[model samples]
Target: MANTSADDLLRTARELFAVDGYQATSIGHIAEAAGLSKSAVLYHYASKEALLDAVLAPAEAGLAAVLHRFPQASDGNRAEFVEPFVDFLLAHRLEASIFINQGQSLHGIPVIDRANQLVQQLAHAVSSEFGSIADRVRFGVALGGAAYILAAQENWADPDDEPERDDEVRAALVDVVATLLTTTSTGIAATRGD
Candidate 1:
């Protein structure tokens, strides 16, 4: 049998998981898809759970880059977080979809656990930038909205086909994130005594 590296197995598995849903795709399916025997696949990734780590490693790296870039994401540096997140979502739409659509179910898995930690880090990073619990809630909402918009959008398997169109889509997302951060609600207190 032809030899397949771990990277090859991971790339194949990522696409399969995205299309078939993680639960539906098994180790055998991935091995067949990658033209490797089950043992060959197992040799690279000891278990199905480990395969997930390979699939999400790139996206995780992207998030890590954002965290490093803005060690402390601040009001003046909101773009540092928003822009890269948007880029990561766009660049890895399928992977991002699997993350958004079905991540909670994988709670016990280490990938999911680490991802949850990153999310908490992100929330803290944003809240630190914007004062008040209300503002923090807004930040969470903004991030959720941003993720949903991109993840739910069409899966452009090959974005290189239309660079201009992809650019337009990314620009719109960037605008949305910027608008969310800039807009703040001012409370209306009731008149004294009523």
Candidate 2:
């Protein structure tokens, strides 16, 4: 029984979860995948739920870092703030797929709660910049919608299926997000004035 650290367990868990999903993946499977015993896996993560949390921690940290980088923007620099998110999604396509596909089932978990809190913070920060609750909601919704679109596009335009179109897909995502931001801002402003 080779000793493995918590970080090693978490890394293996992330890879497995990304491939098999949180619900489908098991502790034994993770341990086998990591080349450690089940007890070693349990030592790092007590349960499947905990393992899921450990797996998502890095993504949560990455998102937090991105949010911190652009807490607010009065000059309509939302694109800059959004770029990191796009990069993250594209870089971790399978993990992003797992998140988009299975996040609803795990939304009640503490890790997911923390992730939502960060999202709320992002909305609040954007609201503070815009000075309106409506703006915050609109911005948040718009960002979410853009993310959904990009995820769909990425899934449909798989690199293995359409290798030459990868650059095009990326460009389309940027254009779509920018358009969504512009439209959402305009709509928010119009509704607020009325």
RMSD (Å) per prediction: 4.9, 4.9
The residue-by-residue lDDT of candidate 2 on 1-194, one tens digit each, is: 33446667777777677666687888899989877899877776678888777667776777788778887743477666556666765665544555555667768888877767776776665455554555555565555655555445644555766453556756766666555454555565688995
| Runs off by more than 4 Å, candidate 2 | 1-12, 33-36, 91-101, 126-155, 158-169, 185-194
**lDDT per residue (tens digit) for residues 1-194 in model 1:** 23446667877898788778899999999999988899988877889988888788787777767777767766677766778777877887667666655678777778867776676787777556566666666776676666655654555436656443668878888888766765444321222322
Provide the lDDT at 84 for model 1: 79
Measured by TM-score, the strongest candidate is 1
Worst 10 contiguous positions by lDDT, candidate 2: 92-101
Report the CA-based lDDT of candidate 1 relative to the real structure.
0.72
Q: What's the number of clashes in each of the models?
A: 0, 0
lDDT score, candidate 1, position 149: 58
